[model samples]
Target: MRIVIALGGNAMTAPDGGARVEDQLAAIGAAAEPIADLVLAGHEVLLTHGNGPQVGNLLRKNELAATVVPPIPLDWCDASTQATIGVTILDALDDALGARGSDRRTTVLVSRTLVDRDDPGFAHPTKPIGRYLTRDEAEPLIDHGQEFVEIAGRGWRRVVASPEPRECLDAAAADTLLAAGYVVVCSGGGGIPTQRTADGRLEGVEAVIDKDLTAALVAGHIGADLLVIATDVATVIRGYQTPTQQPIGTLTAPAMRELAAREAFAAGSMGPKVEAITRFAERGGIGVITSLDRITDAVTGTAGTRVVPAG
Candidate 1:
């Protein structure tokens, strides 16, 4: 089966603030175990990941490097973060495959996704970016025309417009890699949202694309039979966190629409997952949503919310 798996960011960070590279290597190594099993089991896999924490860490590095060189834009920082993660993950997968006595090849493509220049999301700028800063620290950036919004009432963060993605800029390349029997990891952090200039040159935009939405696009582009979204939760819950919350095992597209209308999922959380699954199912795609540990089972259809089209 051709599958696209979107790994979440929390998988990389521990409870405390430490983010040593070796520790992250160990964490991702644990996460990639089931994935390697899938590869060994003969499923064609394309991996994508979220870089929220990674990019934030890179932004701090940029700030520190300002004394030696000028800090780069957030979009460029995201691109660098993607390369860092893709390289690290590819190395781990290579090591894991070798340790398992398999000779499967894994590759990371520094992917780029195309976004509509006129997307309404550009006007809203809802996706947060950069390092979290104290009010005093954020005030200067705000004064200098950088966008900052208060999150959780503790501090401020940069909010970038998370526009809808139109296409994976490197979809053809990813497909080629997949066809060549390589486990390709592409489209990290929604591929560094980009647009075409009037002269037809692609340029980076100062925003993000919803990673789940991007994953759906990648799945469809690759003709994937399954798109498994690995999150912190084991299953998507309706009326989440409420007294009457219920876990959903399966849902028809229409039923999902009704729940979505009632706002069952939080906007910054599970809402996008539902929307992404809906889009994938509506487009003749199959999908599962589950915790990271349950990923292999989710792919085998024994676990997770198996979202299918409404009959």
Candidate 2:
């Protein structure tokens, strides 16, 4: 089966937010094993990952070094993190494949996603980046035209526009790699968030596109049979954290859409994931949501919350 796996950015970093290169490589190394196993089992796979922590770290660095050097734009930060994380993923996956005695290789494509310039998301930045800061520390940025949001006990962090992804500019290249038996990783941090000019030139925008949505787009573009979104949770839970909470198993796209319509998931968390999978399912592809460790099981329908198109 042709599969597309979306790895969460949080999985790329330490639980305590450590961004050390060695630690991240270790994290990705562990994550790469299951993916490598899939490839060894004869399934063609395409991979994409989130960049929340990595890009946030870059943004923080930009702020800290503003006095000594010019800070780069958000789009530049997105590109940088894509390359940084892409290389890390490639290294780890290569090592994992080698340890398993497989000759399959991996590669990364610096992808770009198209978004509308007039997207309402631009006027209202809701995507959070960077570490938490006290209100006093956030005041200076807020006064300088930057947006910050307070997350209850998590303090304040900068927020940016999370526009919807319209198209993936490099999906053809990714598809070609997959066709050549390469475990391809692309569309990191939603493919660097770009838009087109009136003259038809591509321009990077100051926004982030949700990686899950972009994964679905890429899956469709590359004709993937399965779309797997790997998150921290083992399965999607209904009424999460409550006594009535129940783990969902196999569900049809219509059923999942009904639950989503009732706001059964948190918008900032599982909401987008559910939407991404449902969209893919609607298009007649299988979608699964599970933890990184259960990706193989999810593909076989033995684990994870599976979404299929309604009959």
lDDT of each: 0.83, 0.89
| lDDT by residue (tens digit), candidate 2, 191-306 | 98898989999999888798999999999999999999999999999888889989999999999999888756887789999999999999999999999999999988899999
Report per-prediction Cα RMSD to one decimal. Answer: 2.2, 2.2
Roughly what TM-score does model 1 have, to 2 decimal places? Answer: 0.92
Q: After superposition, how far is residue 134 of candidate 2 from its true place, in Å?
A: 6.3
lDDT of 1 by residue, 242-306 (tens): 79988888887777788789966777888888888888988887778899899989987888887
The candidate that wins on lDDT is 2
* Clash statistics: count for each candidate: 0, 0
